[model samples]
Target: MQLDSGAVAEGRVTRVTDFGAFIQFDNGETGLVHISQIAHSFVRNIHDHVHEGDTVDVKVLGRDERGRLDLSIKELLEEPEEIPRPRAIGRQSPQFEAKLRSFMRDAKERTTAGGKKPTTPTKRKK
Candidate 1:
């Protein structure tokens, strides 16, 4: 299959590394869901959300110069803002679990916790 940017597909994780997981699509194309792209929140451990041989749906984010496909599990997930929940002033509600989960997941992505550094702003080209 010709994987394009923004294309979404289902695949089984073929391998896992400190940096990411390799997903093999039914189409025989394998893509890497980088640790950074694994979730919307910080990701401390990739295994927490995905494991080898696990089937998962992912969104195609882009392709690296080497032709490796960059995938995202979070993109396939519903945005926190879109979910309905109860609001509590200066407090967290059990209903906020969905958003909380996302935050915790992304929290693991912190470099201090062994994940990649957050995206840095790039200088505009002249």
Candidate 2:
């Protein structure tokens, strides 16, 4: 199978690296899907989503002059069905609960170790 510049293809994950995964295209061509290109959302760990020997559908976005195939798995996903629009709501983005808990624990530790309020200044009597 001849691989074209903009053809979608399914490939097997041959190797996984810290920065990207090497996909072996059925045509015998291989390409790297950078960690950033793995998902539309933040990817803290690649292993959470993909593993070696797993076959995944990928879209060939384009290729650089160097002939590297740029692929996007997220783009190949079927569009999620749209639901009825909800009324406008005032809310902040959900916090990273794990990170928030860590910060709170650190703050408590600092307060206990220092034994003083951060906002109160120590005063010296004249």
- What is the RMSD of candidate 1? 17.6
Candidate 2: residue 38 Cα off by (Å)? 1.1
Error of 2 at 109 (Å): 28
Q: Positional deviation of 38 in candidate 1, in angstroms?
A: 1.4
By TM-score, how accurate is candidate 1? 0.60
Q: What is the C-alpha lDDT of each candidate?
A: 0.84, 0.79
In the order shown, the candidates' Cα RMSDs to the true structure are 17.6, 9.7
Q: Candidate 2 lDDT, tens digit per residue, 14-97? A: 999888788898678888788877876667789998999999988777777889877778776664565335467675545766
**What C-alpha lDDT, on a 0 to 100 scale, does residue 125 get in candidate 1?**
90
For model 2, the stretches where C-alpha displacement exceeds 4 angstroms are: 78-126
Instruction: Identify the leading candidate in terms of lDDT.
Output: 1
Taking all chains together, each candidate's TM-score versus the true structure is 0.60, 0.58
Candidate 1: residue 52 lDDT (0-100): 85
**lDDT of each residue in 1-126, candidate 1, tens digit only:** 667998888899999999999999877888888897777667878889888889999999998999888898888887675544446468578779889898887877665456556677999999
Error of 1 at 53 (Å): 0.8
